[model samples]
Target: MTAPQRPRVPRRALDGVLLLDKPLGLSSNDALVRVKRLYLAKKAGHTGTLDPLATGLLPLCFGEATKFSQDLLEADKTYEATMRLGIRTTTGDAEGEPLDVRAVDCDEAAVRASLQRFIGEIVQIPPMYSALKRDGKPLYEYARAGQTVEREGRQVTIRALELIACALPDVTFRVTCSKGTYVRTLAEDIGEALGCGAHLVALRRTGVGALTLDHSVTLEALSEATQFERDSWLQPVDALLSTFPQVCLSDDDMRRFLHGQRLKLSSLTIAAEAVNAARVRVYSAQGRLLGVAKPGEGVLAPERLVVTTES
Candidate 1:
């Protein structure tokens, strides 16, 4: 006779964020689910989506940490990308079918010169094989059916783009850019500029805002650790808001703040040069992070308040 199935373990309520070093070939959500199951977290979400072909730092938010994940989503990102010159793909990456191939005759100097043209603010059309929606359907769905859609070019800033290495057909580089920047499109654009088409062969995200890959933990490492050891990898929820300026509230103000009430500027321990109508990280007198608030006129209004239990 077959043994009866064991009872499922109860999921524990978990808070804090995990800097996951996502592995290649797994979608961001798939990776999040695996990590969530490992932690037995009651609530969890990823800050941003990474393509299955890409790998590296993926910030996973849990419980109250999900409240401020938008901060990281809006933050700038850095990546190390490898592009194969002379070959273009339908999806702009290696996963797609090859579309075209041309001779690659450009040297490093010519390639470097071409990359300079894309350094500043430039308009880029979103790729068809993207998650962008059109009339309630993803662009990729239409693309899969061999349909083409008109896409408006969006202006994105490329703060830094450096060519790290160039070996005939393969060109590797690093890029630091604002949110919404598409590196695959960038490779294609650069290839077009060099008189040869190109497609992304490999991509790895190295940094997201203030978070870097160095502090991230891999799935294998988490899987090998004990439950308590895995929990140790989580950073406090407030770690997401480290970039925002802080404002401490008095005991009375803290009480009001927690109740979702507005507080006067006089009640806050703020800097004299604090900007008006600026978002500030709110904290109690004990230095515990309360949440995020916005300054308006002479009052501090709650934008997102952390649950006390999670705090």
Candidate 2:
């Protein structure tokens, strides 16, 4: 006997930003896939990558929101991290085998002083277990093969680093840093400063730019929410570009802008300083978001244009 097959549900055209509270033990992409399936969205992307060992706020973009996700990637980030002093790991986190261990004899004042030394621009050699590439392959591939490669030290800023608690072997801290800052490496450096090697045991991203963990929903919660409730969690596509200056255009200008034509600065309802800014959000006269633009010598050039339903 032949049985009829059920039809697959069609993916919907969804657009917005989701502040997902990524759970531990799942890679950022894994979490994204689960979220995508839950929403049945046609297009999706994440602003940054978080290791499986980390749990925190991860910004997700759907449809038009993906176009501006790069903005969030370049923004500063904040994290709450717990490092195990007196121990070093091959991967810099607890996921790897222990490489070394020493006595933890440092006090609160010493730990605070050690954190102060990292509160500014510093150079770091990217760990071999990172996603950074060398010759088109991830460094972790080389790491798994027991290979070592020469790496260059790059400059990164640590805007703020504060020790929250000093519990001998376990030290907890909060950090606010510029893009590309590696907290695991910071933990290792702090350990070295205290005469005891360390490795990150726990990490939680608290904030990215204007997004915070307070408003994020876990995958479990999303899975149980109604369709309308899931959709309610989505922020407008323009939410990612909230920090950028905005300019609303007339009907004629909106057409020209969408056509990839440059508009004169005088045509935009933006301040002189805003016109001088590198990037500005574009909007239609009807208050609908158009896209993003770059300020040129005397005009605003289209960079990324949003395709609205009406368009």
| Reference-based TM-score of each model | 0.95, 0.96
What's model 1's overall lDDT?
Answer: 0.92
lDDT of 2 by residue, 105-183 (tens): 8888999899999999999989999999999999999999999999999899999989888888899999999999889
- In candidate 1, the residue pairs with backbone N, CA or C atoms under 3 Å apart (3 or more residues apart, or in different chains) clash, namely none
lDDT of 1 at 311: 42
Cα lDDT listed for each candidate: 0.92, 0.93
What would the C-alpha RMSD of candidate 2 be, to one decimal place? Answer: 1.4
Clashes of each: 0, 0
Please give, for residues 39-67, the per-residue lDDT of candidate 1 as tens digits.
Answer: 99899999999999999999999998999
